[model samples]
Target: MNGPHDMGGMHGMGPIPIEADESVFHSQWEAKVFAMSFATFCNYFPVDETRHASERMPPGDYLTSSYYERWLYALELLITEHNLVTPEEIEQRIAKLSQEEY
Candidate 1:
């Protein structure tokens, strides 16, 4: 259970900056990710499952990823684990979206 995600009492991580009047989400995509995660939580996965999935992410990746990125990783992991979607399908979708952005 000890991982980069479990930095509860660790030190030398730097100070947490407090931003006044910070929005719940810094971007539209973050809000969308939250909405997606929430919906999946209610219907397919429990909150703890998602939390654990996020924790299971590669330590290097977990350390560098943003909060919402971690959530996305969890969602993808759970969905794939349950066979709701395949990894190749997810990769294809990402490729499609990437092409559309051009």
Candidate 2:
């Protein structure tokens, strides 16, 4: 497979940056993404497909996205692809939530 997931030893990629004292999740949503991915995997989705989502992503995005972001991206793709939810439904939900009073 020529996907980004197979790009381990290829050249031209810069060195991995080591963050100093990095927390597990950069934001609350990232933690939620992790949990969502895990829940989906446990229920109906395949873990390999989730991992392969990163590979299937556009090359630039795959290269630039964070680990958890990749997981989140995978979760979104799988949910839509599997007919669990539609993109429009998710967007509407987000819009409704954004307009709600806290």
Candidate 3:
């Protein structure tokens, strides 16, 4: 799918920083996202569906978002597309979680 996600063999993107001892996850949420995505893939959606959803993201947003952020977007897209949850439900849940954070 020749999208922005296909960055292979590109030039002038700058060198990838090699960390001496980087952890598998940079933060807790990344691990959570990964787990959530994995669970969904196991039970609900195919892996290719998630990949296509992520590739369907707007080019600017796709390029700017972090890896887990993209995964979250794709998850949301697939779930909403399949009527597992409405966008309103997702927003309501986010609001509930935000309130819990305070």
TM per prediction: 0.93, 0.85, 0.90
User: Per lDDT, what order, best first?
Assistant: 1, 3, 2
RMSD (CA, Å), each prediction: 1.1, 2.0, 1.2
lDDT of each: 0.93, 0.83, 0.91
Candidate with more favorable, higher lDDT: 1 or 3? 1
Candidate 3 residue 70 C-alpha distance from true site, Å: 1.2
Best by TM-score: 1
> Per-residue lDDT tens digits of candidate 2, residues 1-102?
787767678998778788899899889889998888898988987767777776688888887888987887888888999999999998998899789936
For model 1, state the Cα shift of residue 90 in Å. Answer: 0.6
lDDT of 3 by residue, 5-102 (tens): 99999888889778889887889989998998889877999888888999999999998898899999999999899999999999999999999989
**Candidate 3, after superposition: displacement of residue 87 in Å?**
0.6
Query: What range of 10 consecutive residues in model 3 has the weakest lDDT sum?
Result: 16-25
The ten-residue window of minimal lDDT in model 1 covers 41-50
Q: What is the lDDT of residue 49 in candidate 2?
A: 75
